[model samples]
Target: MDHNDLSARELAARIRRGELRASTVIRDTLDRIARVNPQINAIVQDCGADAMAEAEALDRRIADGQQVGVLAGVPVTTKVVSDQKGYATTNGTRLFQDVIAPQDNPFLRHMRQKDAIVVGRTNTPAFSYRWFTTNAMHGETKNPHNPALTAGGSSGGAAAAAATGLGHIAHGTDIAGSIRYPAYACGIHGLRPTSGRVPQFNHSGPDRGIGPQIMAVSGPLARRVDDLRLGLEAMAGYAPDDPWTAPVPLIGPTFRRRVALVKRPGGIDTDPRILDDLDRAAALFRAAGWEVEEPTELPDLREAVQLQIDLWLSDGHEAKLAQAEQEGDAGAIALLRHYADRAAAIDVARFGEIFARRSALIRAWRGFLEDYPVVLMPVSGELPFQQDEDLRGGDVLTRLWEVQLPQIAIPLLALPGLSVASGVVDGIPSGVQLVAPPWREDICLEAGELLERGFGFPALLPR
Candidate 1:
């Protein structure tokens, strides 16, 4: 049987029914990773030996008539940015390669509690600061669809691993477009759950600044929409470590299937292919009995994007900027310098003002989403760019940021966004981004499932 082709949902069901053993799945997953990871460079740290031991224990528990959790024995990979007990939370830098985590982060603990076996740790850019996944410590992560194109950062490794079947699900974090863009580039499904939906805290690292505490979130990336849903089910819960985490239910009240299709939110220039994909996805929703409309009445996304940047660097990102320089990753250096240039101009008063205005922006988006339960926009205004395109110059970085307004804007509002790969265009993956009101990940996932069934996008495995 092709174990690599099975979704986490399917794999877990089969395991529970005794048609497959936990050890079999672990071995198959590790073997597949060994065969493919060399070219992709996705799984930077393989935990196969420990994973096999855990899987064997799970099998023994099953044989002893013990009831396991929903994700029983499913192979998973956690991004290197997160704390996984005993592994280095490298965050893709040579400086911290030996910074071993004393305990698992809340999300990792949750996954293990549900019986998900962590097979490996994926890579990321230094400090997870770049949109393209490459760093001095872990090297570059290549897109499974096209090696020349970016795998997408900072969760590029997670997306690449999931797309190539290294694991059934990959854990990812997003403060900007990290999770969404990687999934779009690698041709998979990734969900950036509403802030506080999933508990997150890194005991090994310093406490996050206000921007990340509110905007950054942990989510799941997978090939199947149902698998994303299952992942959220296991991941969403309160943790004492994260004060921001709220006790919200995993599923929200159902709303009318009304979607607002924004061809170009904030009037940014979108590539022709992305617009075509949006139209195609809108048609699918219309055919699926959804009320779809192209509405010009939308929130000021550009303002939100700028504010998010300011807040991210408001705490005088000099320390991180210094660290980026020390790490000597060209991409990270460029990104930090770009933001530092802007940060230098802003004073404490202006930073305070920007933080204060975040509430109003959230209100504006909430009101807009009330009329339209879902908003379908570009995951990126353009398709995946050549790897390290941002390292070209400041002008290229500016253009890249403009094209990524769809991704950067959502984080400021602390809302949930899902990237669903529609199809391949011009030898690269293309997809649409879905946003809903806070705690409305269920709506995004449901809409994604509809688009998934209509498009029937084929999975892109490594050649």
Candidate 2:
């Protein structure tokens, strides 16, 4: 079998058993990226020499019989928004094109500590906004399944790269379906670890505002459920620099393998195909002995989604507009105009009210979560839409928000969401998401595993 096509679990096993060397694996990965990335536009920046050197070091450690960490030699991509020492943390903006970091973000440091090789950086929308990955600086990232459709953003590059086997696991950040939606779009799996489950700190940038500090989180997008678990284990921890960082157990005793089926969180209708996939996923879980219940109603998800916009728009509007203006990119300017009017009236008091209500909502969600281990829901209201189709007018923004309702809502609860590819719907990839209580990603993975098995493990793109 081609080493590049192996799951992270299989590749790691081979590397540890000395059946393959890290250098060989990385070389194959680079070659795969070269062949497939052009079509997908998934990997935006290459860190070739750095990746090779890291792999060689891992090979040497293996030869010396040293203790190698779990992901030793696995090739991975970092999202542009995350900081990696000595690399430009572009954050998908020309404004920060020269922004270099002297130290790694906590997640990157942790990945390196686990001996994972940094292969490249993935793309995002400008300022990591929007549900599609496109920017004047990095360009659009096409879906591996169908180039016509969107590869959901802001982690679209990561999801595309992972789907195409450019890397076994791609690092991603989630603020509103940035992680899970992309995974669904690209026909793969993504995990949005509960806020602070993963230690995160960026030494190169100013402290983010409360909105981002609460809603944004770093996570992983990968080809398999096991890889997601491995990636989360390597990244989750407590960092003194991120005050919200929490120490969560990497593994805990198994809980009741029960999941709540939320056909549409907040009564919003889901695409028939997406609804079918969710039903199929639920049946798969049932066959696996997991009790699945169709919860009559979900939490006040619409309220949570709206509050997310309020928090994000409060103080972020001017900052985002100024950054876009600085970039002077047509696409950025267009997006700024789309959001500017909606955010025009936000004030300090309104922002504070949103924050206060957010806390209350989180508390309420936590209480509801205590009853259900996992909530299986649609990753998006529909599958990946035509790329740039939404750019046609103002109504598209509402459509984008409607389709991305779940992504926006989950973050407000400060919980984790996992998108597992169930199967393809009419040649386009379709997936279901599993939402777990804050800090309990195990439930998400448990549900993800069942879905993967039922789906028959679809092949990597363009093999």
Candidate 3:
């Protein structure tokens, strides 16, 4: 059997049933990475020796009649931006390549406790500041389906690695669209759980600013909806280190399976293919006994997206821009400068007011979500951008941001957003976004499963 083709949950079930050895799965995973990683540069740091040892130890424990965790024997990759004891949490920057983490982030520790083997560390853009993944430190991650298209930044390496079978699951952190966009671009599944649903803490780095503290979250990217569900189950929990971690149940109460389909939130001009994919996804949900609503009233997505960027840049935009300049990442520099230039006029009082008004926006969104448990929207206005499309010019960046309204807006509302790969359009992968109210990831996953079944999950690999 091709072990590499099996989902993480399936592989773990096989390992637990004694049909496959953990070591064998790990070795196969390592071999797959060795063969494919060079082409995509998804995994920036390989952990073959440690992974092999852990797998062999797991095998011994199983033979001794010990009970392993749910993710037993599954190989996974963690984004380099997170703390993973013994590896440098470089955040894809040359300035901190030597900043070795003294301890694992709470989420990584949780994954380890669940017996998920860390096979490698995936790459990210420098400081993880852009929508395109490239840096002077770890280089760029390419789309598995097409090299000319972006892999989707920040978590691009994780999405690419999962898409190509280098890992059964890839750990990713999202503040904006870091996790979801990559999944859409790479033809995989990524979940940006509601803030605080998954515990997170990076001891190796400085404390995060207010924006990230409230919006950023760590979740999983995988090839199947079932794997995403399993991964979230394993990662969800409270950590003493992360004050933001909420003690919420992974499973929430059942909701009426009604969906609100917003083809273009905020009147942004979306590519025809993106709208087609959304229509196709809505049809699938409707056929599967779901009540689909169109022309639904949604909150101001443009305001939310702009507020998110303002919050993200409010604390220290100039400092970040200067750092990006020093790092020599043209993309990051341009993005920061663009934001700084646009936000230059906002005084401190206005910034405070904008942050204070976030609660009102959340309240409005929650009320809308009360009637429709799931909201299906375009993951991006356009399909995956050509590699480095953000660097082309200011007009391109504006267009990119406009289409990414859904992605940026969800984080501000602290809602769970799921990116499900519907199918391939033309030569590129296309998909839709599923969002639910806070702590209601179950709703998104349930709807995602129906879409997966109706549209069928496509196994994407780089040519």
Candidate 4:
């Protein structure tokens, strides 16, 4: 089998059983990235020498009869926003090009300790502020399936890289739709583990504001459901740096396969094709001895979604506006300008009120989840958009908002959601989002596996 296409679990098992060497796997992955990265612009900075040295060390350890972690010898990619020792943490911004880190962020360090080989850093928009990955720094990352459509942003490079077999898995962070949207666009699986289920911190800079502190989370994207589990287990290791990092097991003993499916939650205009895909997945699950309940609506979704927007942009409003002015990137400027009209007018008292309401919304969602272990919904309202499309335009933003329904609501309640690729419509990937109560990533994983099996896994593009 091609090493690049092997799931993370498969790669680790082969290495552990002496069927493959760490060096061979890492080298093959590096070669794969070199072959395809020029077209997709997925991997930004290569760490060839360091990755090879790490693989060599792992080979010696195995020879010495040492026990390695679950991800041992698996090649992985990290988002540019995450800190990796000896590399500059660009976060896809020119303002911080020289901001090199002396230590690894907790998530990267945990993955490294699991013996996962780091091949390179993936691209992101400047400050990871956009949903489509493009900026003045790393340039634009194209979708692997269709270069004319978006790869999905923030973690766009991660998704494209994983989709094209550049790496076994790629680390991704989600504030809004970063991880899930990219996974949907790339025809892969990505998890947004419950807030702080994975430890995350960038010691090189001051702590981020409340909006990001509450919503931004680091997780994984991979080509296979099994690989998603492997990536999450390694990334979820506990650390004290992030106060929100819950020290909990992401997976637990098996449970019933019952799920809740919502077609148009909160009156969002879901595309007809996507609704058909959701119904098809429900039928597949029903045949697999799982009960699928069609729910008309979810509690507090509209209010929670509004709260998410308010909380997310709370602190960065002015700074981003000024930066947008300086960069003169039309897309960034337009987005910031639109938000500025409202954000700049809010008083500190009103901001506090939003938080108070946020608490209430979280409570309501928690109550709702008690009866539904897994809620199935659309990943995006419609199909992927054209390349370089400006999402900030009035109608465009409305569509973007509707398509990102789940992304908009989950953060307010601090829940975990995963995007499992279902099928493709017109060559564009379509996916279903699985959401669960806070700290119940196991539910997401279980449903994701069922979906992956029901619809046979999609093949990667040939190198």
Q: Best candidate, lDDT-wise?
A: 1
**lDDT score at residue 174, model 1, on the 0-100 scale:** 97
Model 4 lDDT per residue over 1-463, tens place: 6886667887898898778999998888888888889999999988999999999999999999999988989989999998888888988888777888889999988888889999999999877867788878788999989889989887999999899888888999998889998998988889998887888999888898888888999999998988988888898867988887767876665566778988887877888888988998899889988889986656868888777777776457888778766765666676666667677767889888898998888887787777777888888787777776765476776567666777778877889999999876677888889998888898898888888988678668665
The Cα local distance difference test for each model comes to: 0.90, 0.84, 0.89, 0.84
Which of 1 and 3 is the better model by lDDT? Answer: 1
**Candidate 3: minimum summed lDDT over ten consecutive residues — where?**
454-463
Residue 452 of model 4 has an lDDT of 91
Model 2 over residues 150-216: C-alpha lDDT tens digits? 8988899999998888888899999888999889888889999998888787788999988889889
- Superposed by TM-score, candidate 1 places the C-alpha of residue 331 at a distance from the truth, in angstroms, of 0.9
Candidate 1 Cα outliers beyond 4 Å, as residue runs: none
Model 3 whole-model lDDT (C-alpha atoms): 0.89
Q: Model 1: per-residue lDDT, tens digit, 1-463?
A: 8776777888998897788999999998899999999999999998999999999999998988899989998999999999998999999999999989999999889889999999999999988988788887888899989999999989999999999889888999999989999999999989999999999998898898888898999999998999999999888899999999988987878698899999988888998988888999999998888999988578789899999998775466888788888888888778878887788888878877887788899998899999999999999988899999998999999999999999999999999999999887667898999999999999999999999987775574863
Worst 10 residues of 4 by lDDT: 390-399
The residue pairs found clashing in candidate 4 are 381-403
**Ranking under TM-score, best-scoring first?**
1, 3, 4, 2
Cα error, candidate 2, residue 400 (Å): 1.6
Q: Record all residue pairs in model 3 with backbone atoms less than 3 Å apart, i.e. clashing.
A: none
**What is the Å distance of residue 114 in model 2 from its true position?**
0.6
| Candidate 1, residue 237: how far the Cα is off, in Å | 0.6
